[model samples]
Target: MGVCPECRAATYQMRQGKLREEDCLRCGWLAIVGADGTCRCCRAAVRLGEDPAWLRAVLERRLLPAGRPLQLALRMDGLRLKTLPLRQTRPLTTVKLPSWARGRPAELQDDPCVCVTEVPGQLGLFAPCPRSFTREHGTRIRGRTPVEWPIVLAELKAIAAERGVGETWLVHTGDGARLALASRPPTERLVSPEALVDLPQMRPTVQLVLQRAGLLARPRPRLVPGWWSKGRGSCRDCLAWTNGNDQRCRDCQMWGHTHADGPCHRCGRGLPLRDGHCRRCLLLLAETEYDLDHIALEGGDQLWFGGPYAPHLKTTTNRAGEQTGLYGRRRLQTKRRIAVQTSRATAHTVSEHLAIPGQLLLFHALRDWSRLDGRPLPALTPNAEALLADFTSHIRARGWTLPGNQASLSALKFLVAHLGADAPFHETDVRLLAHHPNFAAPRVINYLRAIGLLVPDEKSDALLATARRYADEAPAAFQDGVHRWIDVMCNAGTRPSLPLAPSTVHGYVRRARTCLNIWHTVGIDDLRAITADHITTVLDTLTGETRKTTATAVRSLFRALKREKLIFRDPTRGITLTVAIPLPKALPDERLVGALDLLPFARDKLSLTLAAVHALGVHDQRGLLLDDLDRARGRLTVRRAGRLDRTIYLDELTHQLIKKWLAERHRRWPSSTNPHLLVTARTSADDNHPKVHPRAISKPLSRIGLQPGRLRMDRILDEATHTEDPVHLIRLFGLSPITAMRYVRAAHPDRYRPLPIAP
Candidate 1:
């Protein structure tokens, strides 16, 4: 329960209006029941004079509001106002049942209920009176009832129309019970939601709303015309009017035109442009299009595809310019003309003949057969055709007169064979031989042979013999002839051969004059002129020294003659000749002893007498007496010292005697400190003392005197003459017969008269 706003103190119940005992609790106000069954304080109305609004207000405040009364006039004219019961009317029998009772039961109950019924009149109003009184009074009473709300019913019909429903049913409040009424009945004249919503009275449909939000269905595709078909046009290939091209259509016309542009579409090409028509479609229509046949023919189709080589079936014309019936026959004639012209051109203009078979094979291997038409021909083997073009160019450039055909080809073949794959014609050799004087057959042979080309033996033998005959000539002249010979050999192609050795040729020339000279001097001709014996005799006569000249002069003359080619000597002859001549002998001078006596020596008797006065002057002080001197003399005998004989003579004796004298003198004077002589005897711990030996005196004496046997020879020779006793000199000097004679001659050249020779 809650208090109403009109009567704040009044506690109201929900869904209940007329009350018999309760007063307005708010402001101590009184509850006035108006005829219209509304709350006066709250100005809230209710159904059947029941104040549900007031009750709702009072109950919502603690829960709502209390009832209020309507104005007098409003209450009087309430028939125009609409109303509904606040609560459903319970059955009379159910009113007496307990609160837990569900449906209507068979048990009967009799109870007097105080029910408030609404009254209706001209000034319709709701009055809360007992049902018993209303029945008892029966004074023409009008009970409260529900009025039909035409506005609400019309709104229901509008909702049905918006929802696309056919008919709509609604419940309305009546005085006694609820009644059902059709807001609108289903009928054949019903409109769809789309149509109804589109009407001004209805809202938009779902599809139209979606369309406004940019979610509509995709539009259907449309057809458009092509560029050529959009206007009048003709097919470029077949020249057919595209607009009226039978049943072909524009696309088919395009395809047909494309097909018509092929090689077969021309008039003579044999392929029909139309199904049964010979002329193009454009021509039949008398329309302006390119004259395709005339254009193709004028553009050199005959050159490119007609005649024998054309891929299509032949078309022909006769010599008089009329079309021929047998096309193959005309084509054959044309082919024959072409072949004749080609052959003439090739033969006259081209120096080199391209071997078609070889070229085709090469093209097949390289897989570039189409290139054969324009590519230069490959030079297959050693052949003349390969060289002609180059050779012609060479001869023309040099302003040389070329040889005849046979000679030129022969030379070219020789060159080709000689040069091989790396032929000089292919490179520098071309330039070398291009302007050569002998560019003909014979010269070519020479060139081939000069470079050691293989050739036949017959030609080689002839050339070889000729070359040998002239081999001894000067190099320049010889080489010219050899080159000519080589040329001949080359022309002969291995028929002739030649031997060429630079050294041998040079040697032969050098020997030529010498051989001629030898021949002339010996007065020999034929085989004898070249014989070794005669040559040797000539060398001896030419090289031997003559009595009229010195040996040196003779030797010089032989060398000069040999160098000048005046004579020839064979190194193979190792013979030599011995020549003898008288030479003046040198005689010794007898005054040599007097010259020896002038030298310094010791003055002892043995040194003066036995050693000779000359020997005395030559011997040093210690050399006068030294025993080792004798030992050295014996050791210096002929065998050990390379003398002529082993016998000891005056020179040997003098040296030994001096040695003995020096040794004895050195022993007597052990302390003598002289280097020239060893004398006296003293022991001391000093290194300056002289250790003179035999050689000390002998070496100095030999240097002072030019003795034949070192120093002793002069000593002996001098001593023997000083005594003037040959027997004494011989006995003391120990001279042999020959040696004695030599000494006698030296000491006394005039005195030593050789005994008359016993003849």
Candidate 2:
């Protein structure tokens, strides 16, 4: 071995690593290099003082954002690393109709706006946002539809010849069909295309091609009025003036014609006939068959009832639950394919708001609610009575306010109606059944669990939901590890420490997910595959507080895994982190100094006084009782969380504010049973013993662009400026030792303000 070095010295060569020859990435010259194909020629050129313009240009292109996608992407194809040209999707280009085509409907131009699309032998004519455009002059949407240069050039040549606005015009020479867009009405929002129901057309394949060319933006759904129909909310429930002279809806008109000189031929009843049958008969016919618009008689086809422009009946629901439609119609709709279907738009799409059924019955077997089926709610069962009694007791025991207590009961009733008589209840089903005005899912679940009607199967909160969502993206083993970690955080007695709050667990999961995502990008998914080096690499990418948060979350995950013996070793065992808390600054004098004068209520004024002057947190102020305030001693005692109560001598301003509030509180609730020093009508009106929520003390201040915590910090900081003692702050504000120390350090002149940590 020693003699080999002497022989190798005579060869005079450098052996860097096991290598393969590859073409230089930048230049055509062959180079002895690694798999990346990085060569010395480019480096040598730069070292020899060649212009770096090419390098600078490449860097900008790589680092800077190009609004459109890049042409080439570095990807691995099979075993080979290759830069492939990306497939760029073409977007739609919108153009107006030809001059020959008419724009809007004839009646008032009846809500005018002619929008149309066409394919070979088929044309789609639409009148969108007719209500808006009927009288107003045309307004243009700001975004421009991007067109291919070659196509645009040809289109412009024809437009230029005709001296037209090329962007808004499209003319088909072979078919002599042209669509000319007019400036009829200006719309602030995106418009949905409403089909010209009378003007029939269908060519789905060709439609797709044309749509791909003309669409600039696919707008999120907005309220666009239905054409030639009653579209307002009032109209859906027969609240608007009747269309078809006397008919409740288009469905009713189609059901039977009114007094067509005899009784209905089908039902043989002497009533106003629609399509030669009674309204009920026609509705019955619709359920069993299609083509109800044109009824067939023995002699000839029945006349079309009502005109095409009648309003459809509004969908509705009651105690039977909000139904989209019957299962028979739902299954049929799913199997449906594109045909010459009319483009219809209507509000009340959800139909949950229609608490009462409409007069007209909608056909087609979709939706359960019909005017005939609308029935009164059923009586509560013995079980339901017992459940409500127990739930009410539970609510009172927990000290729920009047509104909160009522909402839980209402939510239960809704679920009962939704499930009908026999369907079992689940936490998710309860959540989904809750409608607008009162989303009473969480409270309802608490009631159900307390009564033992439902088991706890779902994630208790949003944090677990969020963690589970991200965990699903990982490998099965890694996902199991994540969920296991969550179980530890959520379940009691899983750790020596008290169980994590939903919010805390949620935050931890979110941070852990961030690390997992970064690791997965580098081909690592399993927790066992991850090393301390991998964690270090992820930490380096995040800075300051983010880095610390990510580190803590990662360490927690690894620690949990190691504790359960799920992993061989904890990668985070040797890692130690020191994350600084950001300094708090005083609020501007102009903002807080005159806030008291601006405040309208005595309660609000006192709330501000406690926060800004006495350094009392919103929680502390909300928890204060009349007994806690000693007017003779001029002292105020603040109690928050489970900490020791802190008593302080009141300032003259605080005392004056308290005096004003005491007088007001006495006037407002003369017979109130609430023992709290500050009580609102909500807590005072009822003897339910419900305490004031933190929002009561904070909302008024929040509305005026002030925060209680921020004001408390400013007050504490002002005191800390006088003396740098943490113990003094703790005794004065009843802050925990840690928080008090943080306040002192933040206010120190030697300390510089850093970015605020997220939590």
Candidate 3:
């Protein structure tokens, strides 16, 4: 039996785990069982040799109520406890003492030579010292003094418990030591601070003071390397004995060991090789390397290196391993794996053989498959049946604007459906399937051959080559002639005069393509053989802007061909089309007023004014900069398309709108260095200064049911109808003479009276 750590009884066994203490002998209390199978009657604080019990017992006898009052005593260097003569205040009709210090008013007695001070604002003796209690000469003395509040309270508690008193009082000694003594037992008692301190010294009458004054933190056990372990093992690299192997003991392992092999191929570590590399690199090498037979959908798949594919591997290990199956084989859909493999192989083959633009388009189609019809993409397998079905479904899912795009995709899908799953291209005669209108003619056959689908045959290859050129040369019979015609015009020095600007040539070619789509010409030779009657017949089908633009382009193409002597006769010789420009739609007074009223913010008002009153287009408005505004002159300089610059006078409302918006713009982007008047906040902090999206202006106007294009036209018509002068019309609306003439007819149809033709 031994002294219990709790209950102050000798009941616990010396080897408690070997012989459990069920109960304490004197108290008859059951011992509390611990996790380590030891039994304790009370906590360590109440034990015989602990600081708390020893300290409490020492203070109880000397300074507590032997019914004799205690005193505040001090030594020159510090403080000590001694007895004081009791003083009683004169009894009065009513109690003379203040309620707060009713029972303990005697402790407030002064000793001027001693310079006593109380820890104010605290009711209990052992309360924590606040900043107000730690001041000396109206300034904080926390780090300066040795005797702080915690130490003082701890001393007071020791004195109180030893004196058999429930309360203690403290005072600051003139020498800066705070002395405490038993005053009298009060109703409230402070918790003792002895339990909080964890230190080595524990004995009777021991004062558990902080190591540094005012520093209440318990000292933490210092940690040295291998403090808890037995002797550190020998170094792995040099096999030398060491206290701790962590730093390789510096001398034995660090400078002594060098790599037996060069650097590791995977991790680049210069260490002796386990299997031609470090153990870590070997493990990593196994995880990343792939096995086609047992491709894993999850991690930790073992990979085998060596044989045919070993040269492709960055590193290898001595432990040869092979993959048998996937981690989550049951959960992985078979079709998903096939689809992924097919798409990857197809993209790789297309990129290797096709032109850059075609490769990009095909890859985009693959990526945007799910978004094409706003539905989930169907699962596709690598087999021909599944591929063909998925390809058919994809075409029907969304409609494309260009026929050429649809045709190209159809051809690509056909090749992928057959050849993507490693089907032999030699056995699959793609040309034979061309007779079936469901698939496009063998355009994708060359792509399949390039990706190792075909078995080479010189005779068949030569025939396929001729067939491919014929297919490429003829797209649509009508389009074939237009392409040929454009090719002749594009070839430089073949023309009699210097070639027109590329943009002008592009416009002509565009119109020619449109014409071919409208008519039926088998080839370039067929178009060359067209009579004047045929040109007129085609032009008759078109009217207004289409007729004018198309007629001009066709006439230009034929004229160029005639000059080059490519055609014997010019079919467009007598074919002519009149340019007809219609009058712009005028906005109703109420509609205009309603749109202006609906302008929600300053920017909207500014954007609308540029579009409506100033007759600026959306493109021109977006290009407007701070420099374009001439505030002093009250005019704005605008750059229009076709390299045209126009200066327009700003009205008072327009000027104010611009000014207000500019002020708002400056406030939002105070540090912006972009030259454009409009800007947007960058989505990322690292992005460059942003130009406002075109939709920013359009979306606001659209909300108000005002179209920017229609507003510009309304402004043009307003000027045209009101002024009636062609010159004014040209200057204000930026119209050509021909366009102004059309406006003149609309404004004053009866201005030109025709004299009757007499017989």
Instruction: Give all TM-scores, in the order shown.
Output: 0.14, 0.41, 0.38
Candidate 1 contains a number of clashing pairs equal to 60
lDDT of candidate model 2 versus the reference: 0.55
How many clashes (backbone N, Cα, C below 3 Å) per candidate? Answer: 60, 24, 8
Clashing pairs in 3: 6-42, 59-162, 59-163, 60-161, 60-162, 60-163, 61-162, 64-163
The deviation in Å at residue 387 for candidate 3 is 47
Q: Write the per-residue lDDT of candidate 1 for residues 1-759, one digit (tens) a residue.
A: 222233322224221333322233222233432332223443334433345654464344332222234332243433444332222332122113232332223343222222222232233233212121211111111121223334334454455467566631222111111111110112212222222222211123322332333322344364334543455444333334433434423433443553343334334443234433233432322221223233334333222221132222233567997644322344344654565566655544332433332122222121222333333333335344444455565444433355533455444643453334232222223333334343444334333434443242232344345545554342432333233333333343223345334443333333433444455554653321244454455455554343222222223323333333434653323434455432212225553445445545432323333333232223233332232233543432222122332233335545555566566655544443344333323211112334444453345334545432333555666565676556665554445566665665667667766559522
The lDDT per prediction is 0.36, 0.55, 0.49
**Candidate number with the higher TM-score (2 or 3):** 2
The TM-score measured for candidate 3 stands at 0.38
How do these models rank on TM-score, best leading? 2, 3, 1
Full candidate order by lDDT, most accurate first: 2, 3, 1
Tens-digit per-residue lDDT, 433-547, candidate 3: 4444555543345334545555443454343344234324443543444444455555643543554555665667666665554444534335566677766777788778877
Q: Evaluated with lDDT, which candidate comes out highest?
A: 2
Query: Model 2, residue 40: what's the lDDT?
Result: 41
Query: Of the pair 1 and 3, which is ahead by lDDT?
Result: 3
The per-residue C-alpha lDDT of model 3 at residue 261 equals 51
- Mark the 10 consecutive residues where model 3 has the least summed lDDT: 82-91
